[model samples]
Target: MLPRVVRFDLLFVRTDYSDDDAWRDALAAATAVHPSNDFERCGAALQPVESPELSGLTSAQLVGLPRADYLAELAVADAQTMRDQTVLFVDLNELNKQVGRTFRAIPSQVEPIVANFSIANMDFHEFADNADPDGVFRGFTR
Candidate 1:
Protein backbone atom coordinates (compact mmCIF):
# COMPACT_ATOMS: atom_id res chain seq x y z
CA MET A 1 0.00 0.00 0.00
CA LEU A 2 1.21 3.50 -0.81
CA PRO A 3 1.84 5.66 2.19
CA ARG A 4 -0.79 8.30 2.70
CA VAL A 5 0.21 11.74 1.59
CA VAL A 6 -1.28 14.92 3.05
CA ARG A 7 -1.62 18.40 1.56
CA PHE A 8 -0.95 21.20 4.03
CA ASP A 9 -1.58 24.94 3.79
CA LEU A 10 -1.13 27.27 6.75
CA LEU A 11 -1.91 30.89 7.49
CA PHE A 12 0.80 32.78 9.37
CA VAL A 13 -1.87 35.08 10.86
CA ARG A 14 0.66 37.90 10.51
CA THR A 15 -0.01 38.60 6.85
CA ASP A 16 -2.27 41.35 5.61
CA TYR A 17 -4.79 39.02 3.98
CA SER A 18 -5.61 35.46 4.86
CA ASP A 19 -8.11 33.42 2.82
CA ASP A 20 -8.76 31.55 6.03
CA ASP A 21 -12.48 31.82 5.52
CA ALA A 22 -12.50 30.07 2.09
CA TRP A 23 -10.12 27.13 2.62
CA ARG A 24 -10.82 26.95 6.31
CA ASP A 25 -14.53 26.45 5.97
CA ALA A 26 -14.46 24.70 2.62
CA LEU A 27 -11.96 22.04 3.75
CA ALA A 28 -12.71 21.69 7.43
CA ALA A 29 -10.31 24.44 8.50
CA ALA A 30 -7.32 22.09 8.30
CA THR A 31 -5.51 24.15 5.65
CA ALA A 32 -4.20 27.71 5.82
CA VAL A 33 -4.42 30.46 3.22
CA HIS A 34 -1.80 32.91 2.14
CA PRO A 35 -1.28 35.19 -0.86
CA SER A 36 -0.19 32.22 -2.93
CA ASN A 37 -2.26 29.28 -4.16
CA ASP A 38 -3.58 26.27 -2.35
CA PHE A 39 -1.32 23.44 -1.12
CA GLU A 40 -1.87 19.91 -2.27
CA ARG A 41 -0.83 16.50 -0.95
CA CYS A 42 2.26 15.68 -2.97
CA GLY A 43 3.90 12.27 -2.88
CA ALA A 44 7.28 11.49 -1.29
CA ALA A 45 8.96 12.05 -4.67
CA LEU A 46 7.67 15.61 -4.69
CA GLN A 47 9.79 16.50 -1.67
CA PRO A 48 13.30 16.50 -3.19
CA VAL A 49 14.85 19.60 -4.74
CA GLU A 50 16.80 18.56 -7.88
CA SER A 51 18.21 21.85 -9.10
CA PRO A 52 20.17 23.39 -6.28
CA GLU A 53 20.67 26.59 -8.20
CA LEU A 54 17.06 26.81 -9.28
CA SER A 55 15.76 25.78 -5.90
CA GLY A 56 18.13 28.23 -4.21
CA LEU A 57 16.59 31.22 -5.93
CA THR A 58 14.68 33.87 -4.03
CA SER A 59 10.90 33.78 -4.14
CA ALA A 60 10.78 37.18 -5.82
CA GLN A 61 13.08 36.10 -8.68
CA LEU A 62 11.21 32.86 -9.10
CA VAL A 63 7.91 34.65 -9.27
CA GLY A 64 9.30 36.74 -12.10
CA LEU A 65 9.78 33.64 -14.22
CA PRO A 66 7.14 31.25 -15.54
CA ARG A 67 5.97 29.64 -12.32
CA ALA A 68 4.06 26.76 -13.89
CA ASP A 69 7.16 25.17 -15.40
CA TYR A 70 9.15 25.47 -12.19
CA LEU A 71 6.37 23.77 -10.31
CA ALA A 72 6.33 20.91 -12.81
CA GLU A 73 10.04 20.32 -12.22
CA LEU A 74 9.42 20.01 -8.50
CA ALA A 75 6.54 17.63 -9.13
CA VAL A 76 8.65 15.42 -11.34
CA ALA A 77 11.57 15.36 -8.92
CA ASP A 78 9.24 14.53 -6.06
CA ALA A 79 7.59 11.73 -7.99
CA GLN A 80 10.93 10.10 -8.79
CA THR A 81 12.09 10.13 -5.20
CA MET A 82 8.89 8.44 -4.17
CA ARG A 83 9.60 5.67 -6.68
CA ASP A 84 13.20 5.25 -5.48
CA GLN A 85 12.37 5.07 -1.78
CA THR A 86 15.11 7.66 -1.09
CA VAL A 87 12.66 10.40 -0.23
CA LEU A 88 13.81 13.18 2.08
CA PHE A 89 11.65 14.77 4.70
CA VAL A 90 12.03 18.55 4.76
CA ASP A 91 10.80 20.11 7.98
CA LEU A 92 8.25 22.60 6.70
CA ASN A 93 6.95 23.53 10.14
CA GLU A 94 9.11 26.66 10.30
CA LEU A 95 9.13 27.30 6.59
CA ASN A 96 5.38 27.27 6.67
CA LYS A 97 5.55 30.29 8.92
CA GLN A 98 7.67 32.23 6.42
CA VAL A 99 5.47 32.06 3.31
CA GLY A 100 3.54 35.35 3.46
CA ARG A 101 6.18 37.11 5.53
CA THR A 102 9.79 37.17 4.29
CA PHE A 103 9.99 33.55 3.11
CA ARG A 104 13.47 32.53 4.25
CA ALA A 105 15.13 29.18 4.79
CA ILE A 106 17.81 26.76 3.64
CA PRO A 107 17.12 23.19 2.64
CA SER A 108 18.42 21.10 5.53
CA GLN A 109 17.92 17.37 5.41
CA VAL A 110 19.85 14.06 5.78
CA GLU A 111 18.68 11.50 3.23
CA PRO A 112 19.98 12.93 -0.05
CA ILE A 113 22.43 14.91 2.10
CA VAL A 114 22.27 18.48 0.85
CA ALA A 115 22.12 21.81 2.63
CA ASN A 116 21.37 25.22 1.17
CA PHE A 117 19.18 28.27 1.70
CA SER A 118 16.15 27.25 -0.28
CA ILE A 119 12.43 27.76 -0.62
CA ALA A 120 9.94 25.14 -1.72
CA ASN A 121 7.95 26.34 -4.70
CA MET A 122 6.19 23.74 -6.79
CA ASP A 123 4.77 26.34 -9.16
CA PHE A 124 7.34 25.51 -11.85
CA HIS A 125 5.37 22.83 -13.59
CA GLU A 126 5.91 24.29 -17.06
CA PHE A 127 9.68 24.42 -16.78
CA ALA A 128 9.75 20.88 -15.56
CA ASP A 129 7.91 19.55 -18.63
CA ASN A 130 10.34 21.34 -20.94
CA ALA A 131 13.50 20.13 -19.20
CA ASP A 132 15.66 17.23 -20.38
CA PRO A 133 13.18 14.48 -19.67
CA ASP A 134 15.81 11.74 -19.88
CA GLY A 135 17.93 13.06 -17.04
CA VAL A 136 14.97 13.98 -14.86
CA PHE A 137 13.14 10.82 -15.68
CA ARG A 138 14.68 7.40 -16.13
CA GLY A 139 12.23 6.76 -18.95
CA PHE A 140 10.75 9.46 -21.07
CA THR A 141 7.03 9.87 -20.85
CA ARG A 142 4.80 10.45 -23.83
Candidate 2:
Protein backbone atom coordinates (compact mmCIF):
# COMPACT_ATOMS: atom_id res chain seq x y z
CA MET A 1 0.00 0.00 0.00
CA LEU A 2 1.09 3.55 -0.64
CA PRO A 3 2.27 5.58 2.32
CA ARG A 4 -0.05 8.33 3.51
CA VAL A 5 2.20 11.20 4.54
CA VAL A 6 0.84 13.71 7.06
CA ARG A 7 2.37 16.72 8.83
CA PHE A 8 2.02 17.14 12.56
CA ASP A 9 2.73 20.49 14.26
CA LEU A 10 3.90 19.69 17.78
CA LEU A 11 4.65 22.45 20.30
CA PHE A 12 6.67 21.34 23.28
CA VAL A 13 6.79 23.91 26.02
CA ARG A 14 8.85 23.78 29.19
CA THR A 15 7.18 22.90 32.45
CA ASP A 16 8.36 22.24 35.98
CA TYR A 17 8.02 18.51 35.35
CA SER A 18 9.32 18.81 31.80
CA ASP A 19 12.80 17.68 30.88
CA ASP A 20 14.49 16.31 27.81
CA ASP A 21 14.25 12.76 29.17
CA ALA A 22 10.49 13.02 29.76
CA TRP A 23 9.95 14.30 26.25
CA ARG A 24 12.08 11.53 24.81
CA ASP A 25 10.26 8.88 26.80
CA ALA A 26 6.86 10.06 25.58
CA LEU A 27 7.98 10.17 21.96
CA ALA A 28 9.72 6.81 22.30
CA ALA A 29 6.63 5.16 23.74
CA ALA A 30 4.48 6.53 20.96
CA THR A 31 6.91 5.41 18.30
CA ALA A 32 7.20 1.95 19.82
CA VAL A 33 3.46 1.43 19.57
CA HIS A 34 3.04 3.34 16.30
CA PRO A 35 6.31 3.12 14.49
CA SER A 36 6.80 5.87 11.90
CA ASN A 37 9.09 6.21 8.96
CA ASP A 38 12.08 8.55 9.10
CA PHE A 39 11.37 11.89 10.67
CA GLU A 40 11.22 14.38 7.78
CA ARG A 41 12.91 16.94 10.03
CA CYS A 42 12.87 18.70 13.39
CA GLY A 43 13.65 22.27 14.34
CA ALA A 44 13.10 25.20 16.66
CA ALA A 45 10.01 27.34 16.21
CA LEU A 46 9.56 29.74 13.33
CA GLN A 47 8.39 33.29 13.80
CA PRO A 48 5.14 34.60 12.33
CA VAL A 49 6.67 36.96 9.74
CA GLU A 50 8.69 34.11 8.32
CA SER A 51 5.53 32.13 7.61
CA PRO A 52 4.63 33.90 4.37
CA GLU A 53 8.15 33.66 3.00
CA LEU A 54 8.25 29.94 3.74
CA SER A 55 4.67 28.77 3.17
CA GLY A 56 4.07 30.95 0.13
CA LEU A 57 6.81 29.24 -1.79
CA THR A 58 5.89 26.48 -4.20
CA SER A 59 6.65 22.85 -3.42
CA ALA A 60 9.50 22.87 -5.89
CA GLN A 61 11.08 25.81 -4.09
CA LEU A 62 10.61 24.15 -0.70
CA VAL A 63 12.33 20.97 -1.77
CA GLY A 64 15.96 20.53 -0.74
CA LEU A 65 15.72 23.39 1.75
CA PRO A 66 16.97 22.75 5.26
CA ARG A 67 14.34 22.26 7.96
CA ALA A 68 15.57 25.29 9.92
CA ASP A 69 15.49 27.63 6.95
CA TYR A 70 12.63 29.66 8.35
CA LEU A 71 14.11 29.81 11.80
CA ALA A 72 17.43 30.92 10.42
CA GLU A 73 15.74 33.54 8.29
CA LEU A 74 13.89 34.80 11.33
CA ALA A 75 17.20 35.24 13.12
CA VAL A 76 18.58 37.20 10.18
CA ALA A 77 15.49 39.36 9.88
CA ASP A 78 15.48 40.01 13.63
CA ALA A 79 11.70 40.32 13.61
CA GLN A 80 11.38 39.18 17.20
CA THR A 81 13.24 37.08 19.71
CA MET A 82 13.06 33.33 19.27
CA ARG A 83 11.37 31.21 21.88
CA ASP A 84 12.04 27.82 23.45
CA GLN A 85 10.01 25.62 21.14
CA THR A 86 10.58 22.33 19.38
CA VAL A 87 8.72 21.18 16.30
CA LEU A 88 8.78 17.73 14.75
CA PHE A 89 7.78 16.28 11.41
CA VAL A 90 7.09 12.57 11.19
CA ASP A 91 5.09 10.51 8.72
CA LEU A 92 2.33 8.58 10.45
CA ASN A 93 1.42 5.89 7.91
CA GLU A 94 2.14 3.05 10.30
CA LEU A 95 0.22 4.66 13.11
CA ASN A 96 -2.71 5.29 10.81
CA LYS A 97 -2.67 1.66 9.73
CA GLN A 98 -2.57 0.47 13.33
CA VAL A 99 -5.54 2.65 14.24
CA GLY A 100 -7.51 1.73 11.09
CA ARG A 101 -8.23 5.38 10.35
CA THR A 102 -6.87 8.29 8.41
CA PHE A 103 -4.65 10.86 10.15
CA ARG A 104 -7.61 13.19 10.38
CA ALA A 105 -9.68 10.67 12.31
CA ILE A 106 -7.04 9.60 14.82
CA PRO A 107 -6.46 12.84 16.73
CA SER A 108 -8.27 11.38 19.71
CA GLN A 109 -6.06 8.32 19.67
CA VAL A 110 -2.91 10.45 19.53
CA GLU A 111 -3.96 13.05 22.09
CA PRO A 112 -3.19 10.78 25.01
CA ILE A 113 0.33 10.23 23.81
CA VAL A 114 0.90 13.95 23.38
CA ALA A 115 -0.60 14.63 26.79
CA ASN A 116 2.14 12.54 28.35
CA PHE A 117 4.65 15.27 27.56
CA SER A 118 4.69 18.96 28.39
CA ILE A 119 2.89 20.01 25.28
CA ALA A 120 1.50 23.53 25.34
CA ASN A 121 -0.29 23.04 22.04
CA MET A 122 -0.56 20.54 19.22
CA ASP A 123 -2.09 20.45 15.76
CA PHE A 124 -2.32 18.00 12.91
CA HIS A 125 -2.56 19.31 9.41
CA GLU A 126 -4.03 16.93 6.82
CA PHE A 127 -4.15 18.09 3.24
CA ALA A 128 -7.31 16.82 1.60
CA ASP A 129 -10.05 18.09 -0.63
CA ASN A 130 -12.47 18.49 2.28
CA ALA A 131 -10.14 19.58 5.05
CA ASP A 132 -10.09 23.14 6.28
CA PRO A 133 -7.50 25.47 4.86
CA ASP A 134 -5.99 26.04 8.29
CA GLY A 135 -6.16 22.48 9.62
CA VAL A 136 -8.49 19.53 10.02
CA PHE A 137 -7.96 19.09 13.77
CA ARG A 138 -6.30 21.18 16.49
CA GLY A 139 -5.95 21.09 20.28
CA PHE A 140 -4.57 23.79 22.55
CA THR A 141 -3.85 24.09 26.28
CA ARG A 142 -2.77 26.90 28.52
Q: Which candidate has the top score in lDDT?
A: 2
TM-score of each: 0.19, 0.19
Tell me the spans in candidate 2 whose CA falls farther than 4 Å from its real position.
Answer: 1-18, 34-142
Model 1 RMSD, rounded to 1 decimal: 17.1
Per-residue lDDT value at 123 in model 2:
24
Please give, for residues 1-142, the per-residue lDDT of candidate 1 as tens digits. Answer: 1112223212111111123243223222112122213223321122222233443333334323333221211111122232332221222223333221221111111111111112333322222233342323111223
lDDT of 1 at 132: 48
lDDT of 2 by residue, 1-142 (tens): 1111123323221121224454444333323333224333223221212233443232223322345311101111111101111122222223333211222212222433243211423322232223333323222221
Q: List candidate 1 segments past 4 Å from native.
A: 1-46, 52-56, 69-101, 104-142
Give lDDT for model 1: 0.23
Q: How many residue pairs clash in each candidate?
A: 21, 0
Q: Each candidate: what lDDT? A: 0.23, 0.26
TM-score, model 2 to reference: 0.19
